[model samples]
Target: MHPVCEVPAPGESLAEVGGVNVHAGPAIDGRDRRRLERLCRYVARPPVAQERLELTPERQRLVYRFKHAWRDGTHAVVLHPHDLIAHFDYRKSKLGMAGR
Candidate 1:
């Protein structure tokens, strides 16, 4: 994972250490149409793309490749097909809420 080097807007703070990044971005500008649209598009994007998802060669487990490798050096997640469904089902809401 590369360290986050984004410069935050005024009044916002951005920091990263050892590939972990934390940022408190400026408050949302509801009046900014472009920004609002960008945020909406991001939230509505698919959680996983078909290209990044595949069944393991043995056909017993699924592998999900990440767009970027994690700081821990994990490039993909391996799971049983059933477990994958359960994981997605647990994230039930449009707002990415888990469980209830």
Candidate 2:
């Protein structure tokens, strides 16, 4: 599947992608239904919880790895689907720059 270009805003239950309006309620038939189905499938799917932490961005790649346990410690990083999509887009631009 092709990557989605525009990411919807937070708390946005409905949106229009590639000229197709996706919302709740009854489903229509034909191409519109198919488009809506695709949209629902993509959005309904949960985001990948796994994320790589980068320590450096240079000729030599570096990633941060942690392995420790505390008596009562907690860590959390909240990320929305749009954030991940934007990150990928940013990386693509960086890659293009690296080639130059």
Candidate 3:
């Protein structure tokens, strides 16, 4: 089965995990729903961010780095886990469709 969310590119692995249900769209199964819930809980943990990098101070840009979550030399773009969850969850859906 195809994922509800679009496959992420290199340097965007976090979104890959967080966007799973979103990409899976209408095809999401019970297992996927459960996994998404677990993932949302996991990301709620306080110790998730192992480091922080300033991408651009002028633009107030920063990225939280999760060392355990990334492979060596690969970039993992960070977005708020809740935001990802909301994007995929029905709670934030206006028309009850997955929010891309």
lDDT of 2 by residue, 1-100 (tens): 3323344554445655444455544445667977878867877775442344442445243342334434455343334545656776776575563222
Candidate 3: C-alpha lDDT: 0.49
Check candidate 1 and list the clashing pairs.
none
Model 2: lDDT of residue 44: 78
Clashes of each: 0, 0, 9
Q: What TM-score, to 2 decimals, does candidate 3 have?
A: 0.23
**Candidates, ranked, TM-score:** 1, 2, 3
Stronger candidate by lDDT (1 vs 2): 1
Off by over 4 Å in 3: 1-44, 47-55, 69-72, 78-100
1-100: candidate 3 lDDT, tens digit per residue: 3344545664332223333343323233567878778767765866334445434455444455545565556565645555444554754355444545
Better of 2 and 3 by TM-score: 2
Q: Which residue segments of model 1 deviate by more than 4 Å?
A: 1-45, 93-100
Candidate 2 has what TM-score? 0.24
Q: Could you tell me how far off, in angstroms, the CA of residue 37 lies in candidate 2 after the best superposition?
A: 37
- Provide the overall lDDT of each model, using Cα atoms, as 2-decimal numbers: 0.75, 0.50, 0.49
Q: What is the C-alpha RMSD of each candidate to the true structure, in Å?
A: 9.9, 15.0, 13.0
